[model samples]
Target: MRISLALLFAVVLQLPAENGYAQRTHVAISMNNVSVEQILNKIEETSDYVFFYNDKTIQKNRIVSVRNKSGKILDILDDIFKGTDITYTVVDKQIILSTNKMQLVQQEGQIQVKGVVKDAGGDPLIGVNVKVKDSTVGTITDINGNFSLQAKKGDVLEVSYVGYATKTVRVQNAQVLNIVLTEDTEVLNEVVVTALGIKKEAKSLSYNVQQVSNDEITRIADANFVNNLNGKVAGVTINSSSAGVGGSSRVVMRGTKSLNGNNNALYVVDGIPMSDMSAASTQPTDSYEGAGQSGDPISGLNPEDIESISVLSGPSAAALYGSAAANGVVMITTKKGREGRTSVSISNNTTFSAPLVLPEFQNTYGQTEVGSYYSWGSKLNTPSSYDPKDFFQTGVNVTNAASLSTGTDKNQTYLSLGTTNANGIIHNNDYERYNVTVRNVAKMLKDKLTLDLSFMLSSVKEQNMTSQGLYYNPLVPLYLFPAGDDFSKVQAYQRYDSERNLLTQYWPYSTSLALQNPYWITEHIKIPNHKNRYMATASAKYDFADWINVTARAKMDRNNERRERMYDAGTNTLFASKYGYYSKSNIENQQIYGELLLNINKYFVDNTLNLTANVGANFENNDYQSDYFGGKLKSVANLFTFGNVDTSEKNLANQYGYHLKKRAIFGSAQIGYKSMAYLDVTARNDWSSTFKGTNTGSFFYPSIGLSGIITDIFRCSTDIMPYMKVRVSYSEVGNSPDVFLAIPTYALVDGV
Candidate 1:
């Protein structure tokens, strides 16, 4: 156990790959009956090479046939254009394609264009893509960020690099150019997503916050994306359920905070809180009965649609969210459209799962007597051949996902679809899910008013999710089977009883554990679950001025679930009668959230001081309902239905629901001095329906923090420490009492 935890921590602390492009990498291509344009795009997808060609000069419709495996780029290019007028030139990782016939016409106005690309910090950027706006004339920056290309005067130059914003400029008669590209804040490591999806500099924050990029989350795919976060974040613990694939995961930050209340961290998606719509967790009380796990609402979100995740492990970092974030917060930012060329990405991932370790079993021992449950017997000349591990099988998980992003400066859209089909190591344990998402952003009113809208749909089906308990768990009987018996005979786990005229369990052994054939438990006793959900969101922000703006947002999420458990005839008397047992439940949950914010930013004392503030009001309503019915069968031996429930026996019928509402007003202020130090303060007051009819229903919480840059305060050399800061904060948070704790309630007897 200690070794496992140490390994987990090691992975979380490792640094991510900072550089994406590698020079002189081998290329592989195999294609027949495809267009030249298709081949060019394929090369770009498989390697770091980008192809630039003029639509008029190159024959994009020409059919091409080529097969190369790990061959040099120059060799493959020579083979591809040997007999045609097409010519290719390789400059670093960029490929320029053109026809010899166009060179004669180009000499009329073509001139040598020379330029250097640098970052905002004056550092030269290598491998930056530089191209003419509408032609194939382009080249990549070589060592020292210098590039030379052929272009005419007045032609536009486009400069682009990963993690930096793209820039364009029109060339003049002068043949020299110097371009500086600024880093995109959205992709910067120093930028953090704060409460209400506000962007802030990490150095200015006074609390602990960790950001996990989308690449890191999807590095190791799982049915539930949360499982991929197990060893990726500091101060957070993620544990997958024992219920096999697509099961719920417990995510806790800073350890358990309450003895009776929920310790799980709150999940916020795109600035809206997501409700916990998972089934109630179950535990074996006396080893006679236990239930399987149901997937959580957060798992329904497609991982391919996520852009990033931020972890707020301390109360000071989540105080703006009021009582809901008392434990901690996990903020999920989804992908959105961007201004650029239309792009499509598709990926397929397959992974297998198996038991990491198994207990050693003795094959020399034999059962003391016939039909014995334990292998406490004398040694045998011929060792038993029974092996419990044979009951386990390799699990398979496959996921296919695709996404499309495109738009102009005025409007952008993003669409994605994903599907997962998986089976657990235990037989009859399986899970399948499908997801679709659409998002769009538009600018209107002279770029002052911005509108954003998104929608999502998800469907899931799961069966026989295995749990780590004695009851209904195949592992129990498989491991406890007596070695002396003929285990192969029990492979046929069911048989027709002549007297009862119905199928019955085949196992003849009986003991205190009430063990049945392992195969019978997996094939006969069953549990199935299904869920469908949809969410919609819309928001509008208008820039009244450069330093002030007002925004309004609203979202609705609805989920429906159906779960069932069925036991075949001749099962254990503790859970089922001679007839049979069946249980069914239907649950519906919904959450509606709306918010309005007033944002302000100003500079004071000739830019010596800066102040940023936000005042907001928000409301949320949650409605939940569930219906359940279950009982043992009456006269019909194998028929399982509500009408066939035995009237003389104690049956189960339940109907319960809850409606909770919360409203809050919040404000935050940040004051900065010369970009060196900052002071932050926030306050929120919440009114809850759980405490209705009492003044105590209203509660307030506030937090204050201060941070200062060490290098700036002491005037130390930045070369030794480019960024260093010390911070301290104090905060107070309130946890809303469980619903109905302050209200009167009654107990029901015999379903009255």
Candidate 2:
């Protein structure tokens, strides 16, 4: 039957508020005059009477109610369904019941059939679907394709394949029964993970989206996660940097949109999008630096902590996300809680790194001058790499991580921790990072609902000691002096260069403007920058009717960054007067989202279909505050030396900035049939704070996608081949980089 996907979605909207699955029940039954043989035979003809006294089937489908009196038939089954705390409906004697109650049917004779479902090359089909013909009796194969089913010696067993033809065998007394299903051309279809954690045949979906799984994911490492898709995607460019700690990479999809605002893509963890690049809000005026010195912020996240990541690069792919997804979005899925048994996982890894970019400098002649030339006054001079001996260059770095995971059937959790340290080839130039994380998921609503939560914390420290800007130039004329006969008293003239140029002739370790002593700067010239970060999120969902569900979510991310860069008065580096400078900044970011989802399903002829609809709202706010101070003190004190109440000149100032936003509504639908064809559409509107009242209006974006199953259409299954598939996708989203752009500007002048 052809149906509007909206109708199916409306039905799914009835799911409970929280996963609402009932507990299991127990029962035992003894047959009377009607022998077990007759009951089994009658089951085939009866349409209204359903029986469930079996041992190896759906646990919930097991009938706990029993019958002792003669043929009151309907009354007996009805009583069992209600009294045993089980639920089910009897349709024409065929028990349409809940999976919570298990059913078991018994046969007297012993029939053993055991075989492996391996590929043509003899590799086991770990998860192949297997079942008995003409009945609901079925079982999935183990990872090794090894299966064991019991039936009467004379009964015939049946096997069916998803992409292969059916096979039936009459059970004999033999101990082994092996079977194989060929990879047919008529069975190629990509299965995709969709809304509300469901899997659907790709052909039925109408929205424009793409999926990548299995072998493709295992081929990369933690740091290069996004880099692997460089040339494969249609509208994405992944750029790499060669800075400290392997400058994080950037991913730009489509073209840059939005005014002067940031067009960087948004990252969603599991289902949460919360993170901040560890860069400060302010930079030195004459410092010749970017607003943010660090690379992409998302790079700090541990890739091993992720199970799968899908890029919702278009409005159609992220319609449900509203305004936050205006530029684009990446949805991530983490490992989840499982049932039945216990599994343990442990992994240890290490990596080595080297700088990809470096700066060049001229290094010849020792500390000397022209007219006022001074050899190594009191000390002997030697040729070095940074000297006339410029024939050497070197670089090195290291990183490592360790993790463990173990969980029970009811509740599962994952934990990991790691550390990375890098050193630049430059003197005293380097960066280091340490991180830890814990994630947990629980079965709060039995089989219907579940809960997921995660927390992460990390710290980064960096040091850069070089003073070649101005001031501290030893190559200055006044500081120049002649060397001693033995060059033993060079220390006296060290601060006083002999051939020092007054204007700009000097080495990197000259003065602040002329290049100060890097060794002296590293020890006395300090720019101690440190950052601490924390992130968290919590959300819940419940099903109302079989087709309806409601969800509420809240998330937060906060970070503190502080830096103190100053010059100390020491004898070696340069002659310092009284001085000190420092700055501190605090940033806070938060977001909240709420939504409702409805899913509908139907089956007819040779096809099955599904529909989903959802409504939601999102709000985000970001704020930053900074404080700066500088002064001339009595003498050069250590970092902690000068307080706000210090010895001399004072230059204190503060700056504040903020961003607020809101997004209206979004919706999308997908359709599939016979598991071969797919189609989808998505749309959304948003309001941003970066734009002013006159221009801060709403924007709409949408996209469509189509796909086909080549294998299923061609019927290629045979004895020689095993598996193959092909797929492609295209989508579009909006861009609003300068949310705070297009505003009026003003000029100010000091009044006499």
RMSD of each: 18.2, 12.5
What does candidate 1's lDDT look like per residue over 341-382, in tens digits?
Answer: 688999998999998887777788888777777788988889
For residues 1-752, write the lDDT of model 2, one tens digit per residue: 11123422432453232112211111223434443323332433333333332223323323343463443443444544454444343322233333342221123343335556754324355435466666665554543466666555566766654545556777664335677665454553233455333344444454434554322443434343455556655676766543333345566667777655556667776565554342342223444221122335465555555665566566555655655566666566665433333445544444444434434322233445432333432333543233211211243444555665656755777677766566554434556667778777665654346566777776766655222223322223122223322222232322523343211112223233333333343344555566666767666666553345565566666666666555553432333343333344443333444334444433333224434445555555555445555543344333444453243433443454545555556566666544556666666677666555455476776556666665655767556653324444455555543433466554343352
CA lDDT of each candidate?
0.79, 0.47
> TM-score per candidate, in order?
0.74, 0.62
Best by TM-score: 1
Residue 72 error for model 2, in Å?
Answer: 14
Point out where model 2 deviates above 4 Å.
Answer: 1-235, 254-260, 275-287, 290-295, 337-347, 355-402, 465-525, 544-548, 568-580, 591-606, 630-634, 637-651, 710-732, 737-752
Provide the clash count, candidate 2.
105
What lDDT is reached at residue 40 by model 2?
Answer: 33
